[model samples]
Target chain A: MSVDAKERPLTPATEPFAEPLAELDRQRARALQMGGAEKLAKRKAEGTLNARERLDHLLDAGTFKESGLLARSARPEARAKTPADGKVAGFGKIDGRWVGIVSNDFTVMGASSAAINGKKMKHIKDVSTQRGMPLVFLGESTGARMPDRMGAIGRSILGQDRYEYRRMRETPWVTAQLGDCYGSSTWYACMADYVVMRKGATMAVASSRVTSLAISQPVDKEDLGGWKLHTAISGLVDVAVDTDQQALDLAKKFLSYLPSHSNQAPPTYPVPEGSDEPIKDILKLVPESRTQVYDMRRVIKTIADKDSVFELKPGFGRAVVTALARLDGRTVGFIGNNPMFKGGAVDPDGCAKVTGFLVLCDSFNIPIVMLVDVPGFLIGIEGERRGAPGKIINWMNALALCTVPKISVILRKSYGQAYLNMGGGRNSDEVALWPTADLGFMDPRTGVNVVYGIREEDDPALFKQKVEELSRDTSAWDLAVLYEAQEVLDPRDTRQYLIDMIEVHRLRMTNCVGEHLMRTWPTSFG
Target chain B: MAEVKVASEITGSVWKIVANIGDKVVEEDTLIILESMKMEIPILAPEAGTVKEIRVKEGEPISEGDVAVILEK
Candidate 1:
């Protein structure tokens, strides 16, 4: 009736507890336990999750196998004062795939990276690289421990092994910005394949407190390292969520789309039964009235596999929406403008959003689906002040650099510079338009004013009559006659069209080279 | 005791500003707007002042947070 020892799951050996070395191990365990408890309480008070809690939420239940549990600082005084040097380094399984994790506990002397902690982190990274395991960093730190890093010892620990930061060709890495992530935390997050952040979390080269003092200004955390600043302005962080749990969930979700390592194929998940719906229903999702706005998000959700969309920067850029979603269980990045905002116009912020999203998708090998209903880039002096011109050019540049399979669906008003920016024509692998699409340089009414030089107020009745005449020339049929779009089809067929086109592009050998852009994009903003 | 004011920058509406005249205004305190694009580009006070004049109203079309009046501090 006794179970064979070799067949059982490994357990801590009792003999090790009885040996003289047991005292040293117990002391190490006690220090770590106490440090963990205090850190957990502080983190809870701050409305943040401790490193271990974050890791637990990130990995599958009961799957973590820790390493370097006994490593301590080499600094004589600091060694006795810190336990595990405030870091928990180990390996764990996320969705049955192995991943390396290192979580920093700020409660232990501010979670500063001392000599031993750095060594532990470097070792974990090295092992993950060699084994081709995905590495995850649950980063929240106060930078390098000043005491340990101020002298000769500091000089020795200053530079990481070049190979440590030199991203391995195959291993995927992810980082979570859980709290105040400065210095090393920021560095690791920048290096990740996917970086997720809590809404109020701060990730910057230096903490706001430090920067404020240095610059002599009252620094607000959001202003200093807010999601808006990073996601919209710098494109440093990938996605920002509202809660700690959501950040953890995003990390898990992002990893699901990527291979455990570059050399292997991405793991496939079971297609949820009955998830597929008729692609024709996508037509009804968009409103018939060109002036009446509908939520692009609803259309996106309907066309994509049920509940597969994971939106990024949902708040910062109200005009354009970027999301990572799955269609038929295959990962793709979706970029579209919400007609509800500025009539789906590409404003400065919207342009920035699309540029960042395109770069991310290109870098990550995620094919793109551009849902176009753009009136055009925002015009007028306000747009110019906000650098609209620069952002538009930037978006176009990013679009041109993209090598992934890009499919453009002109849901409606594909006008002006935005038409080219939204992967129209040569910018896309396949371009299709809904029956109602109006692909043009500008709205017909405005086009008449610019072309005819007739002021609307000068003779309202006459100008109105001319505008109506001009409107007759712009329509989906007009663009089709010129072959601006490959084909104009019924709205309901959009999903199938995209699915078919993506499949065709995916099969091409050229697609592979473009997918590697994610691997080579600079990890941080200079 | 008072002086005429002009718009600092040209753009859109007065999104918001941190200062008003007769409110112990200090130099470099954001006076008002021109909210272009999605950003709130601020127009700071040129000099510290006392209640002088008000030009732009919230939600009103403002090329800049135009100064209607001046400070006598």
Candidate 2:
């Protein structure tokens, strides 16, 4: 101000535009510094990237076009302290695709929420939605600003936007928890389609200080909302990584599997080398004997494109495996039962996992491939206590509403009501079966005991006869005879069968888009 | 060294005891096999350790979270 004004001479009549433009430059420079060099260096010393630096790392070089560069606090008293109002929002490209981004600035006032920054967030959301681009939120905040949020005026300011939490699935929303995330950060993370968190980051409704005060007991931050708790118990986070850069990289990778918006098909990559190789290894991975258990994930890897399987909620529901993968370079969702845990029985948690995955695939127009090896829904008082029936029905309801191509492969066991939920019968567009597929109402031994009131040990001869009687017409050929299975495949041909069938069933008339039936499904349930 | 208690992930009866005391086992090694719903589910060691105690016998009923073996890591 001094150099420009003194050199130009302060004369309103002589130079009318000089003063205002100089002031603008000064304010812009102030905003660019972002809580001064000392605070940024402190963050650097702590091995953390500041908000702008994170944006640079996440976005393509020279692609960040900032939206609220001149924005500060709306409150006159706090104007000087709040630059960009604690949030940096802009339009950027992630892997050459346009995406709206909001990165919270923790150095300034803990990146707290206030009136002006809320407007910036709303603007980004509006433009991203209207322009048909995905939204990425790099979340790390200390929650709502205090004193500014106290009193009747604060009550009026809070929750003015009614559609803040409404997720219509118009665009793929991706979020990252890079540090302590609370309030808006946690809310957006919960509503996202894919959420990745740093290993040490914590995400909760409020900071531990307020939580401990409210509960009247000391609380450990990690225990309250850590990576293990969410990934293993809560199922809120899709993946947890070791560093901030890893979280951002995962966010980019997740978006790679989805479209920029629900109206378009996901981008495809070139088919990887060796994709045409036979999956003869699948024969050895799945045991022919129905009673034995094997790792279903190995079967999934053998079927999908090489190194393209990205698993989601891997720790929460041990019985089911949901992942995003590519077949012949096109995106598809895999819902497979894992016999390694709980005998591949769908529990309440597993039901919720499948339901959410179905919603995502349907909303984004990705085809689904279900690898059926489920014994049945786990039955017990514990399952009943967790509302297992409602969750199972919810999964069925979402699957029925889906309009995209669904292909089912009955690898081994597909029994009881779980058969319908796992893409059996009219539930899927195409059904393939291996010769080893075991289709029945229940396990033969258990059914015989329930009907005849005799253990296999007591009447071995009768048990064998009864088991054979019950197992009649339940083989892969039997299903094929009834025209239920489109094809009876050799275990080796499973991968090529899925690829050709997906191409045949691709929604050509609709431009490879689905009906978006489950667009309004709730984002969080586990 | 740490003492890790290996627990059953499901409620089942012990069908077979494959590991004995003083035997060294690696992660995912089958220490005991449990049978439920006509499926033999192996209770695997979560980490590499020496088996210090086998607490459940074959055909004994065990509930979920019931520790079946104590491993010295």
Candidate 3:
């Protein structure tokens, strides 16, 4: 302020722009510092990756192209304290395929949602959608920025983006719940096609503090939206892991099974060793007796490429196993009835899980391979209250509308409406059966009692005769004789059979792309 | 010591009780077998524990989520 215009020294005719550029360096250094060294060290000691480190672990090495490193809070007073506006967002190569990412930096103002970060999120989402790339969200937030969102100005900006929550299955969306997730974080995770949560993470509408105040009672944070609630009860999360690395690895693995966008075929990998080998162990895993229970996951693993089975919602719907795996190097969705739980009967959660998997596979041009061994649907008061009927029809509806190739293999018991839902009749492109396959409206012993009023206790011999008669024409051989199933195979030949059938049913006319009839189906139904 | 209540995951009649009171068990060891949909479904120990109580008898019908056994670990 001491120097007047006349007293100030004249600038050099040619300035190197060194001072201004140094200020640019200072600004970038401040953004990179990210809530300062102490907070970042505390985060490191807490055994979780920082925001930038998460991006490095998630994306291919040296491929992250950050979008808004200079972005700060919209409020002038808060600008100095905000870094990346609490959100680190950009585009990066995941396994050499481009994906847009948003990683919440908890070191910076709790990574809260505010005007600048919202714009940054919208920008990444828009570019990812418009340019055909998968989008990922690494979520950990403390709801909206306080005071900035507490007034008329906040109300005006709250829902200004109409398409904020509108999900179009244009490209795959994946999310990871890394810590306390509330508000937008929870919504994004809920709407994500695939979500993975760290075991200790919590995701909910509002944090327990607000929730407790609203309900006038103390609320346990974990009970509100912990991994157990999401993975085992609500079916909101696909998998729960012990750490952030596992969650990010799972995200990469999941993206490997999907295409960049709905209009293209999923990328294929080199077929793993032993993929074409006979699955002799499958015979050992499945019991020959119709009433014996076995783990269908073993059968699916033997049929898929070696080390290729990645299961989704494994804990929630124990009756059904939905997995993304590789068959002869190409991506395939495997829906199998797990006989180890509920005697392989479908339940409401199972129905919803299968329906969601069907939508994902069909939308992304991945063919489906269903391993059928279901007895029937589980009927009970709980199922009725959970809208089991609607969920069942929703599964059927998605299956009928799906344009991707769907092949089915009947392992043992395929009965009642579960038969059609598991890809019997005209539901699948090709159906095969093992010698153990039993096609029936119901179990023969149960059918005898329901139809002929025959009980083994009352008339043992007549009941046995009636059961035998009821089961007479329900064998795999009968189905083969009637041309209902395309072929009957020894259980060991299942791996090769599925690979051959998938080759036969490839969408040659459409350049390996499906019609994507289920593209607009809801991301989750339960 | 922690008490764990083992519940039946399915509605079925208890076919057999494999673990007796005070028996030491490991995780995933089948403690009871229930027959439903004409298939034998084993209710396995959720964790390593000593069986403290067997709450049902053979052939007794039980609903899903009903506590079938209690274990102390």
Candidate 4:
């Protein structure tokens, strides 16, 4: 490694570091290159993809051009060791659109950030922002390097970069929580526009080790920062997937729905081959029996353009479903209830999930389709303890504020306050119900009990007779008679109905904003 | 004692009242709500209730949980 001493100024130069820095850069790159390969093999053995591999999956083939390839720590002792500071920074294209990327390799000193690595990150961020390219961070790190960032020198490294520090609305940023994402990874994820996490990955403000020592309590990885906790309770992450490949695919799919940068509209892609599926089969997808639970996901996949239902928070909030799917190759947000869990009743987590999704959809001008089959909010002591009522209200508030085209389809039961929350009445622009929909404040059986205090067991004949009488007035026909729902149609017509509704509102208003709540929603906790 | 009248939010028939005369109650506690379509409606206490009288029997049809009356002190 050649050190150009002549270019080294006695005082720190305000200008960019010169070729004297090249020796440090080369050493860092070599260190990372050597450590990265070993680490990659080890990770592959464990059935996980390394950060760089995940980045490759995210970008177009052969399009990556890395920057700061040789950057390393400026500290004399640290500079003599630790190359590339275990981070690979670069720019690449995903489907022809430019994106800046950085993937931390945990094998090199545990992928800890050093002075030069920080500078490299800041530089990449600056370039991406200035050029209006999306920034993607494949984060898998152990926070800052202790040796490099421990004293005054470390504090200097910690000093903020004036150019990239300001989060002016310039470009979109994405972060993938691949593995143990701590410190800088956590920070970047929190600040990103979109964040995707692998199912088994851990993301925390600090690693379990640091947290355990500091707090004097042992913490498990999942307990410290699990996918379920973030997606369900915190609402910090946007999506959690089963595999690294899914995470990468989601990153690509998410970017497809977003513009290359804030100033431009999301690039529209030609509908992929066989993307359109017949709408006729959608009816059979939903079972005829209300008591029988069917996979709502199948219903979503059928309605959306084939292969376009990119689900977010799929494992969390099992009751409420949210996804960004393409309809005729245009991105829209779809929120529905899954009867598979708690009979499609919205619990606190489900409510929070839908609330965030609604905010994102409204902010991004993504039209919404709410498929209703709610049996009201989940009721129980557990529900109360979770502050279910508050979350439900929050959901309602978000729904009320949304100005984009909103459509509602009553798939089955639309009971109680849940009816209003699911875009019933005037909550949506178009409200349609399936023929099987039973709209009422409560089910007939429950209604009979509340009114008469009669157990059928007490007087079976009378109780049966009374239930029959109450059922007469509580059907979909009753709701339609009062104009509560506009139309009740066969389930087969849902696709055509939604397509026509979207077309009607396509030009109704212009949504040109660069950032939506989904993009701005925090990906990490403090 | 104040009168504890259980009114249903929606018009439905009572399924059953788990509470009876002289049953102590708390706020928002479910006395009984009538079931109409397929929902388990809870008729909660307007105030804590001590069953003063049972207005209607289990088999009779009633709107809301107005079948039993309670007194609160």
Candidate 5:
């Protein structure tokens, strides 16, 4: 007969509790096995750490307080093998801040199929959202398990987890695509605020094996979803690292720069020590010749704090360079036109990139610094087919919706609707310009051709004189005289002016965060 | 020897081909000029090489990343 422990506490003499205690010890041993020692050893041989080792490296020492550690698969045969339901979900400290982590244990059933895995994921996501902590997903799953999800209805029933698909950007979400990420993992990658992918990791909706079968064509996994494809072309993955260690480190660093949640302002480093390097160097970096293309990246790095720029999507939509940097220790998002690509004309892709960046900065309360040098939107058969106008207007809407402090500095060639899109005239809180800035409906050469109906080839001498006449009227001084731009600054004074502007405008924020005007705008997947 | 292709960075009409086929060019040499967005964009040779082929003639429309010249070293 069993003793009624509910009536009284157990004593040392209680013989009935001995067997149950032994069983508890056995269950604990089973929970810790995590697909057994052989798998762990194999993973170690692969020159990569196991799930627990990764958690050890990612979280602060002695800080990981795990939840759902004893959770096993619902299937009878799979129950003993699928320790922690092939998933590790818990709260931990990263850089001394609480963060929720969900890592798939690829050793167990390939971390692919389990009902409780989805539930555990939801638990961490909900907990992270409620507790105002960032969520990290270290996914390396092989997609839904076919054996467990064999029935037709089983596939549909899997989506029943309410929190799995529903997105609430209460806290920053970061994902690390460590290995073969498919199905739900791909969705999480897209939905994340930032994603770091391992160089060899394959991320897609389905594996090449299955995709090839369905389409009846051989598909290379790398070509289908490679780091180069995402970083340079698709603009899906934010950062790609060569090692798993690097991915974890970069994630921690990225979070350190951002606020814990959207309601708060981003963390700011101490003001840059010592005076800035002579800003006069920017003059030498930028070519005065309107026809020449110089490296805009150099100009950005020189103006912003030294080594502060962290560029996003450096390959895709390369005509525009979007980066997060510090100006006088204040976090600012920069959108500068790269004249090296498409002469800094905002293409359809570039428009989409800028729009998404504006929404992100607005959401995180990072102030914006626009270095305008766009000639105009891409005008061609391809640009039209790509829906350039739709993208342009969408970006314009985002810029208008952004409540964060926006300061526009026209470097050169601010023309067409692009002038407004780049925060010209009334669009920006404060508009400044360099002495060489040109603000107009179009470039003077194009303006001359449109107005006079005389091509440059038809009358070379007349065209040159006409362009000069138009150019004289379209200078930065003309705009300043008309009270269009507030100040026409020298190129050297731009850094200081921005620092001062940030200080002055920041007074408008009471608790450091803005009104969250574009809070609901979706982050761009590309 | 390696073959290099100099590509235009903008969608524009080919205004002029400065370096003819079989001509020698240094790094940063303008191989072809494209007129787009009301500006003349010079497609430059990435390395010192001899021009192997001219991809497009004058007045022909070309898109971004379209190869304008091939160079053999």
Candidate 6:
């Protein structure tokens, strides 16, 4: 028993309650010890914070109100050894907004899953969902507890909850993958709308050790589930950071732009004191020669509010840049193609990134701004193997379902289906292009070569003449004569055009967040 | 010393050679310009290094992932 519990005097009416209350206090103290002081010290030695320390860093000061504080492992032998049943869950303040958090205590049997911990997590998950409060999961577990969750008794876990994976998106959900995240940890990480993983952490359905044992060959942890896999290939994690503090800070930063629930408008910030960066700079950043590659981030930074751009999954989709930014203090989802990577072609990774970003924006009522300078969809044997066509269709499907205001500015080349996917024609609220925009199905040289079967070496003069003839079809004047594209503004006028477009569409706001069509969409690719 | 592999980002015919074997180049220095869509697309050196190998000759067709130059740092 704790020092305080044994000292309290027992009255005749309260005599029966005295022993039980002392027992409760003793259990709570043991639970707080986690795997004991030695293990906690070891965690600190590795520069990793323990369970409660993570919550302290994540939530505002002294706001954490823990639930199931006295929870013990259901397996009788494991009760004292598994305090909080290897999990710590509670309600707390994130930027003063109520949120529920579940942090796994890795000191206890590698924070393996047990029935008591599952119940604790389920309680917070349900309560957070019902109240429309954001829930954050700090995962560092090693799959299901083998002893308790096996055989006939294990079947009870599936029947414990009927409403599984039903996310109404009433409130935003965030997850942080800190260390060895297997099984349920991986599932919840994928279910979160925004997930951040730390470097050197592994997140997979099964651990490398188990896979090695099953296959009779050693498996590298990184090969199974590393930050690079999720960021560049699987498209599961949104951001990868270097520290636990950075991961926690990112989750808090994401929630700042959102409302406590879907019923309210996304929060707006005070416009920083400045006119948009000299619009003339945009022309300088974009290449006059259509074939040249230039950094598109320069243009994005100039147009968006100063220092407000936060890029997500940057390393994954090298060709396309999906980011969150403020335009005149209003939160907006920003997508732009970087020609520096693969000549601004939409690769499979780019397609997957854009699709998820569009869904997120549409669900939260954030307007989209696209800086389009696409060549076309990437073509190769690799593209086919990566399922590029299906991803392209998914991206188009998402674009069609988006009800938020979309404004696109075609900087230069906008060719093939890429133009349609980037909010051309009836897909967007407004579509405008620069005077130098090249709108066509394909490049002029390729068209001439395909039509006339003439190579530059075969007949240079004839090929030049045919190329010039085809180039005329791609000019902005051709589209302007048809009145298909909106006013062709000077590249410098793009920033003003976008700012005015956002204001022009604001009057159409119905005031409340929509019945978010993508509320229950898979947060990450399964 | 680490060797940097200079891979082409797009498929095109090499139009001009701006750097040769043993040439010292700085990051972003255009080593070769490819002709695509009748436009000049330069393949720049990714980091400062001495050109150790000229992997692809002028007028050679190169696609994405095809290494055109190798630099010794």
RMSD of each: 8.4, 3.7, 4.8, 12.7, 5.5, 4.0
Fnat measured on candidate 2 = 0.64
Tens-digit lDDT track for model 3 on A1-526?
0112234444454668656755666677778888889999998999999999999899888788888998999889999999899999999999999999999999888999999999999999999988999999999999899878988999877888999988888999999999999988899998788999998999999999999999999999899999889998899999899999999999999999999998789998998777765487777889999778888888888888989999999888889999999988899999999988889899999999999999988889989999999999999999999999999999999999989999999999999999999999999999999999999899999999999998899999999999999999999999999999999999888888888999999999998888888776677789
TM-score of chain B of each: 0.70, 0.97, 0.98, 0.71, 0.95, 0.93
lDDT of 1 by residue, A1-526 (tens): 0122234444455755455555555565555563656657876897887766777788888788777766777877766657777888888899888898998877777778777888889988888888988899988888878867897867888885766567634577888888888888998887876788888889888888899999999899898888868875666777788888998888888788776665454554556655557455665667676755667888888778777787876655667888888777778889988865545666677777777677667655678999998878767777798788887887888888887789998888878778899888799887888888876678766776798888888888989888788777577787778787788878877777777888888835653435454455454421
lDDT of 2 by residue, A15-116 (tens): 778777777767777887888799999989988889998898999987888888889988888889888999999999999999999999998888899888
Residue A161 shift from truth in candidate 5, angstroms: 3.1
Task: Write the residue-wise lDDT of candidate 4 on A1-526 in tens digits.
Answer: 1233345543344546645465554454465463646666888898887756776788888787877656666766665445566788888899888898898877777778777788789888888988989889888889988877888867876766765445554676788888898988988887775789898899998889899999998989898898878775666788788898998887877888876665554565566666546566776677776655556778888888878887877756677798888877777789988765545777777887788677656655678999888878877677788888887887887788776788999988888999999999888888887878887677667777888998878888888887788767656678788887777777777877888888787633344442343344433221
Best candidate, DockQ: 3
Q: Clashes in each model (backbone N, CA, C under 3 Å)?
A: 5, 0, 0, 34, 1, 0
Which 10 successive residues of model 2 chain A have the least lDDT summed?
A1-10
Name the better of 2 and 3 by TM-score: 3
Interface RMSD of 5: 2.1
Which pairs of residues have clashing backbones in candidate 3?
A: none
Each model's fraction of native contacts? 0.00, 0.64, 0.80, 0.00, 0.32, 0.40
Docking class of 1: incorrect
Question: Which pairs of residues have clashing backbones in candidate 6?
Answer: none
| Candidate 4 C-alpha error for residue B9, in Å | 27
Off by over 4 Å in 4: A1-53, A126-132, A147-172, A190-194, A198-200, A215-223, A226-246, A261-265, A270-278, A459-474, A481-483, A507-526, B1-73
Residue A240 error, candidate 4, Å: 5.5
Most TM-score-accurate candidate:
3
**RMSD to the native, candidate 5?**
5.5
lDDT of 6 by residue, A275-326 (tens): 4755557777887888677867777888888887888787777788998888
Q: How does model 4 score on DockQ? A: 0.03
Writing each residue's lDDT as its tens digit, candidate 1 over B1-70 gives 5653534443556666555666667764656644543334455554577646666677777643355336
Please list all clashing residue pairs in model 1, or write none if there are none: A170-A262, A280-A492, A363-A517, A363-A518, B22-B51
DockQ of each: 0.04, 0.69, 0.79, 0.03, 0.34, 0.37
**TM-scores of all predicted structures:** 0.78, 0.93, 0.95, 0.74, 0.88, 0.89
